[model samples]
Target: MVLSELAARLNCAEYKNWVKAGHCLLLLRSCLQGFVGREVLSFHRGLLAEAPGLSPSATCRGGSRCSPRARQVIKCRNEIMHSSEMKVSSTWLRDFQIKIQNFLNEFRNIPEIVAVYSRIEQLLTSDWAVHIPEEDQRDGYEGETGSYLSASQVNEVKIELLKEELEEMYLQAEEQEMLPEEISNRLEVMKEFLRNNEDLRNGLREDMQKLDSLHPPNPKRDSKEPGRETPERKD
Candidate 1:
């Protein structure tokens, strides 16, 4: 539904083929002023020249205070995604609370976007780490396994979620410039996740193919390596 709206608004001819959230952002870049839409906007490296400037660190600490609110949102997302500890500081999360609201306000006219406002507020105002009851802990995930997800509608939602994860994997491999180890670990997690979800495994063959093709490239050699060798051998 969201994609349909974006397709209509952006006049994205290939929007029907777009399967990930990043695709929407990619299209949005072409509309921004001073942008030729050529460079890698996926990294949010090109949004420093407009509207509500990015918040704390839009790719770097003490981020641009004059870029689009979207820039702040994107940078905050990148920070969380790239965190090795899989955690964020309270100050950072609190700042995100402010930034996300500001960003969402930018699209107040979009009903679908605005609909999640209350939900976002609920999430942000609470503890970042969910505190499950002791009973739930003891029963563990076994109590809920496959029982609630049997509906076709639920399956479709799961499929979309898998596509989003695949999209992020693509970004990590092709855009984030992650270390080879980091990419490899994430790849294994994704592979195992797919293997467990038979429905997803069967439904997302094409998506999985793209992920497979994104095998991280070999790490680039650093010119400043400590043991760098300079043998005088002719090729």
Candidate 2:
């Protein structure tokens, strides 16, 4: 299975544990494509945006935003999953597989990426059946839902459902007089359970650790330093 291969490619202990998280990403991609019945980039972007804490990293290792490595994975996933009249060449798929392996290797070491992975896993595992379509099930697909419509009929159904949800949210926001920024932030938090948040979970793990693997907390590199730590919150 692709999931097993992904796990084997990430040999490190941290990566081994994160395999479940990677599986979550693959599942989400399949679910979104199946539900929307379209493989367009905007649809992909919209689904990901709505999911809490599920954004591709624009920067890596002090490099430029939307780094080539990240872009390649996104492109590869789209091409492979959305194979159409202009089918992706086998050569590209082979190269993309290697890129994905390398990308996961780099991704496993970064705390932010780890956080994103965990958050997505939490979301998918919690309530995925409501979004994925039954007709979208392929050979390897494994989601907890039955077929509702044929693949051809799925797009219209999903579009109408999404439209109603968006309208309801808009009306609710207007009723509450929430600002645009506040509404956006609240939407991200809505998908996650408070106790299962990465920050709280990681903080608890930190307290139990015999040693801090990231090195002794530096006063100069305290939580205040940009990119050093997430902002601290009172329990």
- List where candidate 1 sits over 4 angstroms from the true fold: 1-67, 127-166, 171-182, 185-235
Over the stretch 23-112, how does candidate 2's per-residue lDDT look in tens digits? 334543443444335435565677677875765643225554666776877776444322222133335534654665556556575444
Instruction: Give per-candidate clash totals.
Output: 5, 1
TM-score for model 1? 0.39
Model 1 lDDT, full chain set: 0.50
The candidate scoring highest on lDDT is 1
RMSD to the native, candidate 2? 23.1
Residue 186 Cα positional deviation in candidate 1, in Å, after optimal superposition: 5.5
lDDT of 1 by residue, 1-235 (tens): 3323222322322211121122223223323322323333644554554535775365555644545887787886565444433334556666777887787677576555555565455444532221223323211122311111123433454466556666787777788677757777876776675665565567788877786677744578787768878778998
Least accurate stretch of 10 residues (summed lDDT) in model 1?
A: 138-147
Give the residue spans of candidate 2 off by over 4 A. 1-64, 86-89, 110-235
TM-score of 2: 0.23
